[model samples]
Target: MYHDCTQVLDSDATTYPDDPPVELAPHTTFEKDGYRVTELGFGTHSGTHIDAPSHTEPDGRTLDSFPIETFVFDAVLVDCRGKAAREPIDRTDLPKSTGGDLLVFHTGWDAHWGTDAYFDHPYLSAEAARWCADNGYHVAIDALNVDPTPTEGAGDVSGNAKDKPEGVPAHHALLGTDHLIVENLTNLDGLPEQFTLDAFPLSVSDADGSPVRAVAEFQP
Candidate 1:
């Protein structure tokens, strides 16, 4: 059985407060032209998208640089919604021997999508990020960001800090030469502990990130 783990990309959909709002223009409506076609516009990281190392690291490889095999792998899901807002989840939350498995963290933050609370969701600890990297696990999460909401720039965040560090410690910790981060995932509650994860990005040349149709298929 396969569970779709992607968010709907639309004008009304919730997006990271810092990213551009999704927009579309139909240039080929049947009323005017032959058929219907749309020109979509949104930030690369908008909606259910995967972040490449280049998203954080200046010298990191872009999404197009990764081999096709890196986008498919066995994965394990962890429930850590019990973690508090504005706090890091404890490293003990992860299973041992995560080697070669994608780790998808279900924070249940998707419940807050389209609300003020979405911006204040909990995040992975820098230590946890490092642990995943150290154990060779590519990471994905169902949160607006892997890092805590930024200190500034995101508008109307409940606890916007004037001095919130611009630094994304968790992103920095998790991103490597070929790291993958899938943000704003939903429907995680129905997935089994183990599944086959396929999260391939568009081959936009030198793209920092791309929207992904992420999914999980469990064994019978």
Candidate 2:
């Protein structure tokens, strides 16, 4: 059986500070004697989503441009649970078992969901991001943005400094490559330390990103 690793998107789901929060409007309701339907008004990158190359790279591929095979691949999990604020995930933090096409980081940070702590959690370093890109890993993440938090004197304006360093090293290192990234994952704690991860985004043409329904299956 497969256990879901994606976070459920709801009106109350936590969103990035600058991103618009999810909104649900009723187009029709079954209780109102109409078709059971609802219209969602939110960003494409909302909730447990995959960021395509186009999301950060100017000439990168969009949601529909990715091959089906990119969505299905062998995966491994890396647990980085007890790090303090602003700590970067370097090469040594990863486990030896992680040699798959996909790498999922189970930081146990998802427990901070809906609070300010989640948004300000630790993230990957530029070296780590570069390592993944150079080594051919497809995905990476914790529960928050990969960029560091902006310091008081820093000239950065992306509002990612809370989790990253002076510059957006992680983004440049990771998204600069062809690898896709999955962010804001939850329920990873229930999964085994290692498992087969299956994460695929919706095939929305021209979309820079899409929310994914990710899952993991492990054999005892």
Candidate 3:
């Protein structure tokens, strides 16, 4: 069976504050051109997307630099649900054995999509991220970011890792190790513990990141 874990990309889609919002305009109508053509505009990291090392690390590898096969990964779901807002998912929250190369953290935060609470969803601790990186596991999460996303309210601290304010240590820990990150993933609750993740980014030249049609495949 195949399950689509990607979020829909429309005008109402949640986007990073600093990124361009999604736009869809009628370029040609059926009445005039006998066919419809819509013009699309959105940032690379607009919706359910993958982030390359260059997204944070200077002089790091871009999405296009990776081989096509890199998009498909054996993934294991990590259930980190019931966490409070702005809480950190520490190393203790992870299982000792994943049996996969990708760790898909299910925070159940997708339930708050399109709301302010979504930004306050649980985030991965830098130690947890480093643990995954050290074990050569890529990371994916059902939240805005692996690190805490500071909103208008509450504290801005992500985790107990040092260098908290200078940069997103969780991002640095994973990306600095050349591990890719997938964000805004949904429908993880419907998936089994193990599945095949197929999320291919756009082939844009020197792309830092790109929206993906992330899918999960597994036996029913």
RMSD of each: 2.7, 3.6, 2.6
lDDT of 1 by residue, 1-220 (tens): 8889888988877776667899888979999987999999899998889998899999988888789888897888888878766656769888865544688888999888887677777787778888887777888888888887863434344354432435687788777635578889888987878888888888899998999998888865
Query: In model 2, how many backbone clashes occur?
Result: 11
lDDT (Cα atoms) of all candidates against the true structure: 0.80, 0.74, 0.89
lDDT of 3 at 48: 99
lDDT of 1: 0.80
Off by over 4 Å in 2: 96-98, 149-167
TM-score of each: 0.90, 0.87, 0.94
lDDT of 3 by residue, 1-220 (tens): 9999999999988887678999999999999999999999999898999999999999889999999999999999999897877888999999887588999999999998998778877888889999999999999999999987755554644434431333588999999999999999998877999999999998899999999999999999
Please identify which of the two predictions, 1 or 3, would achieve the higher lDDT against the true structure. 3
Q: What's the CA error at residue 14 for candidate 3, in Å?
A: 0.4
Runs in model 3 lying further than 4 Å from the true structure: 156-166
* Tens digit of per-residue lDDT, candidate 2, span 7-66: 878898888666788888888888795577777877877888888878878888787887
What is the Å distance of residue 117 in model 3 from its true position?
Answer: 1.0
Clashing residue pairs, backbone N/CA/C < 3 A, model 1: none
